[model samples]
Target: MITHIVLFKLKDGIDRDTKQVAEAVAYAREVGHQVPELVDWRVGWNTVDRDISYDFAAIGVLADLPALQRYQENDFHRLAIEKWRLISDWVVADLEDQ
Candidate 1:
């Protein structure tokens, strides 16, 4: 299995409560349900206050690299990413389960 994780930090001057940001967060939380290749999906806004903490995070598991690629290529997933791109900078990591 492959675990795909992402951390998002809002861009300077963007309000976290704005419609775009809210929708982006919601989309991130729901994409797994829309994509057949994704399993065990989870996403949320960060509640902790730390200088280095990102504003949001998402994690999902896929069966393998091809599954992960399919998830990335999904239309809904791509739209969600575009929304995030408007308001934040993000980083991603993919790991294989032992």
Candidate 2:
């Protein structure tokens, strides 16, 4: 299996309480149902308060690399990226799951 992880940080001068951020968060979670390749998914704001901690996190599990790629190219997945870009910058990592 593969785990696709994303960490999102609000952009400079952007606060987490705005309507844009709230909608993006809701959209991120909703995208899971729209993508067929995801075996599992979790999306939410970070719980801890720390400088090193990002504002949001999304973790998705897929069958393998090909499935992960399909998820990346999915229309809803792309839309979620577009939504996040308006309020924050994000980093992603894909890894094999034991």
Candidate 3:
């Protein structure tokens, strides 16, 4: 399987408060539920005391590289990512079966 992980730093002036942050987190949490290639998904908000250089995270599992690619190319993904782009500085990595 492939594990796709991502972290996001909110753009300046975007996430104005805890409510905004919660909404953004909710959006990310919906991705895997709506996308087929996503076998599993988890999303989180930063709560550690350390400097929050990043505000959000997404972890996803897919069956293989092709499945991961398909997830990346899907319209649902495009829309979701575009929404994230307005609020985030995105970072991502994908890991395959070990």
Candidate 4:
């Protein structure tokens, strides 16, 4: 199995309380249900406050690399990502379970 993880920091001047931010978070949380290739999906706002911390996180599990690729290419996933792009800068990591 592969674990796909993403951390996002809101861009300058983007308010965390805005409707757009809420929509972005909701989209991230729901995309796993929308994309069949995603085996598990989890996303949330950060509760801890720290200077270096990201504002939000998304974690998902896929069966393999091809599954991960299919999730990325899924139309619903792409649209959700576009909404996130408008509000944040993010980083991602993918790991395979041993």
Candidate 5:
């Protein structure tokens, strides 16, 4: 299995209100549920670590490279990536078993 984690730093001047943040997080979570290749998903808004420069983060789990590839190629993921890119800066890391 692999853990694919991403962090986002939203652009300047975007609203960070609770409702707005909640909506974004909800959308992020929804992506995984809609995509079969994603084993799990978790999205979080930057709260305690405001100075770290990222506004949001997501963690996704996949059983293997093929699963990850499928997730990447999915239309839903493409849309999510487009939407996310419009609002934030992002980073990703993929972890695997030894």
Candidate 6:
């Protein structure tokens, strides 16, 4: 299996408690539940506060690279990512779950 992970940092002046951010979070969570290629999904805000910490995280476990690609191409995944794209900067990593 492969683990796909993303971390997000909120843009300057963005407030996580606001309606927009909350809605984005809800939508992202739905994608976690709905994406077919993902064997497991987890997405949420980071629990710690520190200069080096990102504000949010999304993690997905899939069968392999093609499955990971399908997860990325899923429509809901695109929409959920667009929501955060407007409000934050993000980074990703993919790992082999051996």
Candidate 5: segments with Cα more than 4 A from true spot: 18-24
Candidate 5 lands at a TM-score of: 0.85
| Candidate 6 lDDT tens digits, 1-98 | 99999999999999999777898899888986879998988988899999999999988899999999898889999999889988889999999976
Candidate RMSDs in Å, in order, are 0.9, 1.0, 2.1, 0.8, 2.2, 0.9
TM-score of each: 0.95, 0.94, 0.85, 0.96, 0.85, 0.95
Candidate 2 clash pair list: none
What is candidate 1's CA lDDT for residue 81?
Answer: 94
Q: Candidate 4 regions off by >4 Å?
A: none
Which regions in candidate 3 have their CA more than 4 angstroms from the true location? 16-23
- Summarize candidate 5's per-residue lDDT along 1-98 as a digit string, tens digits: 98999988877876666455555666787887888988888887767754766778889999999998998898877877877766677889999966
lDDT of all predictions: 0.92, 0.89, 0.81, 0.94, 0.79, 0.90
Give candidate 5's error at residue 7 in angstroms.
0.2
Worst 10 residues of 1 by lDDT: 24-33
Please state the error at residue 57 of candidate 5 in Å: 0.8
Clashes of 6: 0
Cα error of candidate 5 at position 31, Å: 0.9
Please give the RMSD of candidate 2 to the true structure. 1.0
Q: How well is each residue in 1-98 modelled by candidate 4, as lDDT tens digits?
A: 99999999999999989999999988887897899998889988899989999999999999999999999999999999999999999999999999
What is the C-alpha lDDT profile of model 3 across 46-78, one tens digit per residue?
Answer: 676467467778999999998998998988778
lDDT of 2: 0.89
Q: In candidate 2, residue 88 scores what lDDT?
A: 90
Best by lDDT: 4
85: Cα error in model 3, Å: 0.5
Highest-scoring model, TM-score: 4
- Which pairs of residues collide in candidate 4? none
